[model samples]
Target: MATEYLSEKHLRGFDKYKYNAKDTSPLSIYVMHPFWNSVVKIFPDWFAPNLMTFLGFLILVLSFILLSLADWSYYASSRTYPQHPPVSNLVFLIIGVGLFVAHTLDGIDGKQARRTNSSSPLGELFDHGSDSVISCLLPIGVYSIFGRDEKDYGANILLLYLIVCVISATFYISHWEKYLTGVMFLPWAYDFSQLALVVIYIITSIFGYEIWKGTYAFGFEFRYLFVLTTMGGSVVLSLPNTIWNIYVSYRDGTGKNRSFFHAVEPAIPAVLLFVVASLWAFLSPTDILQLEPRIFCLTVGIIMSNICCHLIISQMTETRAKCFNWLLVPLMIVATLSVSTNLGSLELYLLYCLAAVALILHFHYACSVVVQLADHFNIYVFSLEKRSPKAARVSNGTK
Candidate 1:
């Protein structure tokens, strides 16, 4: 089945695909976009857009892995646990530099594609596909900054789960909205969020993570203000705007204009993702979330990224979206076994197994899709060149 990830139906849809997006973000319009327009010029025309996309993702992963290793329990900076030894000030600097470079590369890939005359649906897919993973990783890394104490500063384990879900949902829905409406309603909050996080990481690098602790106004911790703003941007700004854009598209007869049920079909998998992860965390006999927050977050984020990838494929190719995601079945079984059956260490092992499976499936899917598309499109995914004519002829004959 993995070999057939893209069927004839999907290929046919891709043949007709054209990228369309609406980005009215003041930041993107007046600031980042212009900066990217200039920054992209520095690159040689030989630079591949997909290379930038993939490299940026790798940089972010490097920073995330290094930070996780340094702050495994995510309390290295905790005032309440001084013996935990604060994350080296250098880690924050690494993350800050890494994120800034990654974010900049992301902003310019599309512009680079357009400049090099290499624009295609494949580039968008690669860009946002990596983006889906970054969506989860960015927040999980930020959680380490605030640390895991609800009263002193950082959010507890449960709240962090919700934050990851909310951020992932906002991103997934934006793409899903495109599936329904045929227009990507780019969120203004995205640019601000990335820049803000970079600034925060930089601030921590200079002044230490302790700056976030105990600062208060109107009887609430300042860290909670970040939490409220993050969640609020999703529930208040991003989602409502997405719904409105979809509604307008349908009302004006510009969208796919399917029935309500069909329009909402893509949401089932996304909803189930949150449900399965929540059940596992909330019902775990071992208190998996609190006892093993890092693994839990990584597991859930990988699963969420896989789901988002499926959604992107559906939207980009105009293929019928899945009403039920396949990963949910196995994940649900894992959750059930962890909670309903007594397995002691095996439960944590099950969680490990889940993360492993999730990671494997995600990579397999990403790699297969990229190879398939590269062959079909007669292009290199990370190089500014076309495939050999012989290979292209063979690819077209079969696929």
Candidate 2:
């Protein structure tokens, strides 16, 4: 399989690459490391790292499905009359727990790999790829939990769009930094953000969705405040660090071609995704908030995941960075339809199906790059084998 992905020459070329992990989060150093290390100590030696990665992803997918169903129920019930159906507290609790477990499993996979002497670049790529998928889903789950209101359609869609963009941008910036510096740095926000999201889920479970819809201080609803703070604060905390890192890299001669485009190119996909989504919302016959909102959210998630996958592949293959142009086709189709004819329900459904297909191809491309890299490294995706005696000796000598 690996041979099908990469040639012998490319394999030799990748052998020179080394990965560096630089995490400076206090929460990670003090809390997560200790907790994860303890968990790693108890993990069975036979556990496969890739399996753990897949498990986490599967759990998140289950959570997504559950939440989508719950959201659909609310939408269906509301369509008959005016009020949203009361969602069971258990639904929220279960979803929250699922997300928490997914996050834990995600963290544990790396430690499991290192403990079992199975660490490889493929493992790292797999982890990030899974994370990229989850990042998009997380916001969608949050949005679904807060049932949509007809009155707030404009604000709701706009906020959701902004949240998605921010999440994608932050993720892109992190990888862009790695592309420039060779070191992957984890900030404090990265450590706590997942926990914060987990807490939000739990809180929603306990208080119910209505609690978030209620007014909070500053004449804002609790959900809006939460979204604003979380998304805005993340941008505030992360954007500066990204800029400083780029500046430092340029000053030290580590990064060449210090240009604005270099700093902003990685973010272009997210920006384009936002634009596409916005155009869809503007052009659609029905309000985005009134349509199957979960589907729209899912579409955004898939597009964002596609972008993340593109960035990862570009970095892995040492190719020039570029946004996924194929994403624009759906947008263009919708745009043309809006001008030429009103999009009926069937047309809209077909457009969504097209977007879904695009997502599948995007993900496939990401997986292909990973497989090629794994072949180059002579590592199996699901298993780690001991190096040859001579190879081991060479590694030890290098150390």
Best by lDDT: 1
Give the Å error, residue 165, model 1. Answer: 0.4
Candidate 2 residues lying further than 4 Å off, grouped into runs, are 1-13, 73-84, 150-155, 217-220, 256-268, 385-399
C-alpha positional error of residue 89 in candidate 2 after TM-score superposition, expressed in Å: 1.6
Which ten residues in a row are the worst by lDDT in model 2?
390-399
- For model 2, how does the per-residue alpha-carbon lDDT over 1-399 read when each residue is reduced to its tens digit? 212433343344345445676777778888988888787677688788988898889988888788777666334212333465555678778877887777778878988987888877678778888888787777766676554454432135556666866786688778887767656776557667788777877886788655555566878866567687768767877778877876788788775343676656776767777776777666667564346555666676676777776666556545556745577567566655754566667655766686677677767766776666654455566766654534322121131
Model 1: per-residue Cα lDDT over 1-399, one tens digit each: 235478877877788998898898888999998899999999999999999999999999998899989888977867888778899888899899899999999999999999999998789889998999999988888888888866568777787888888999899888998989998889878988999989999999999988888767787775678889889977787878887998898889999988888888988888888887898888888899998888888888888888889888988888888888777777899898888988889888888888888898888988888878777788888898766767563343453
The TM-score values for the models, in the order shown, are 0.97, 0.84
Error of 1 at 164 (Å): 0.4
Clashes of 1: 0
